[model samples]
Target: MKDTNKHQGLRNQLAKQLEEKGITDKNVLEAIKRIPRHLFLDSGFEDFAYQDKAFPIAAGQTISQPFTVAFQTQLLQVKKDDKILEIGTGSGYQTAVLVALGAKVYSVERQNELFKITSALLPKMGIRPKHLSFGDGYKGLPNYAPFDSIIVTAGAPIIPKPLMAQLKIGGRLVIPLGEGEQIMTMLIRKNETQFEKHEFGEFRFVPLLEDKN
Candidate 1:
């Protein structure tokens, strides 16, 4: 819970690394720099927290690498107060980033441990997302349909049909699609029936499992 000047300097250095690697979104970079990543990780890994690598977290999930988080966020082009539905609340790191960008984040986590931990931790850090629900991420919070942006933090075999349907027209969905390895994919809803899709590159992530509660 203690964020010293050294920790802040490390975060700044990590932000610079992300910038050198082609992340040009200032807001996204700032969010990366602002969040105390070490606190989201187990205290044992605090020494390596700002190394730009994912570290294992509770519930068999790994905190996403900073570059990956920044890349997905840049694709989202988040606007302040825009509603965002985040799939996979593991470690609550990404959710904090979205909150820092001023999004009304609605996050879903299938693992109850992760959900409860993140639900409790976020508020302590003054990051109060619109809602944090414990349930299936694939379902995509239908009751709050039509999010301005949807980000899938896990690797899905295929895009969840419901999530596609849940996005507002012209809204964006950034997800990783595959099994052992994933292609970073982005979808922009064009109209009632069509979507424009593109693949950014490849990255590995924990699977977006089904029906785990």
Candidate 2:
């Protein structure tokens, strides 16, 4: 809960490193510099929090690598108050970043453990997403459909049709597609039946699971 000057300095360095690595979005970079990443990790990993690496979190998930988060955020091209649907809430670090950039996020976490923990933790850190749900990500939150943007934080074997159907026209869906090493893919909704696809190279992520309570 304590974001010390030392932590601030580390975040500054992390932001600079991300910029050098081609993360050019100033809002995304500012979000990285402001959110206390160390707070999302276990105390033992605090020293490693700002290293541009993923570290283990609860429920057998890893907080996403910083570069991956920034890259995806940049791809979303988030605007203030944009309604975003995030497929995995993991450590809530990515959720916090989206919030920092002024998006109203509705995040779904498949793991109940992560769901409960993050639902409580985020507000404590003053990062409030619009909603947090424990459910299958493939189904998405149809009740809150037509999001301004959608981000999937896990590796998907195929793009879930429901997610595609739920996007607003001109919305962006950033997902990691594949099994072992995923291709970071972004789909921009062009019309009712068409999407513009782009891939941003490879990344490793835990599989996006389905059919769990």
Candidate 3:
């Protein structure tokens, strides 16, 4: 119980950071507050959990910063019961955030090692999303098309076209575009034939790869 209190303290710090950074979405802030960032990170680095910096997790990938996670979730405009597709599960931290926001999450991870860790952690965290898949996230999940929101954790040179097509009309997809250094971008599917683009800010993320493991 005392440890839970410490966890809550970290969460409060995260909330304060988000609020100071102008993250006004109450739901997004709430999700950030509720998800345990420390638990998702390596035990050795648990002290840095709320420090607003990406930390290396199991795979070559790193867990995204709190602001980046909150920023993307805010841009996606998730609603309760909305179907969300997340590319690059990583530590399953963002997946846990999506679940906290009350979205039915479908997350895909390309690295076998990271996928395995996340699959085991989600249940431990009590964040049971609708589905978790191990594969190339660039393909998205065809079987569960027309998602209300989509978020890609890694940086892709180009937004995967199939992912755009998978968005429902008026749905939003938030992704990072570029190599090495990237800019966080959002795409709103205005209709079946068109999308509106918005550039949020610059961010750095691991490359979105196609490797099986």
Q: What are the Cα lDDT values of the candidates?
A: 0.95, 0.96, 0.89
- Residue 11 Cα positional deviation in candidate 2, in Å, after optimal superposition: 0.4
TM-score of each: 0.98, 0.99, 0.96
Clashing pairs in 1: none
lDDT of 3 by residue, 1-213 (tens): 123888888889889988999899999998888887888888888778888889999877899989899889988888899999999989998999889988999999988898998899889767898999998888999999989989999999999889998999989999999998899999989987999999977899999986554
lDDT of candidate 3 at residue 196, scale 0 to 100: 94
For model 2, the run of ten residues with the poorest summed lDDT: 204-213
lDDT of 3: 0.89
TM-score of 2: 0.99
Clashes of each: 0, 0, 0
Question: How much is 105 displaced in model 3, in angstroms?
Answer: 0.2
How would the candidate models be sorted by lDDT, starting from the highest?
A: 2, 1, 3
**Residue 94, candidate 2: how far off, in angstroms?**
0.2
Return model 3's CA RMSD, one decimal. 1.6
lDDT of 2 by residue, 101-213 (tens): 99999999989999999999999998989999989999999999989999999999999999999999999999999999999999999999999999999999999999844
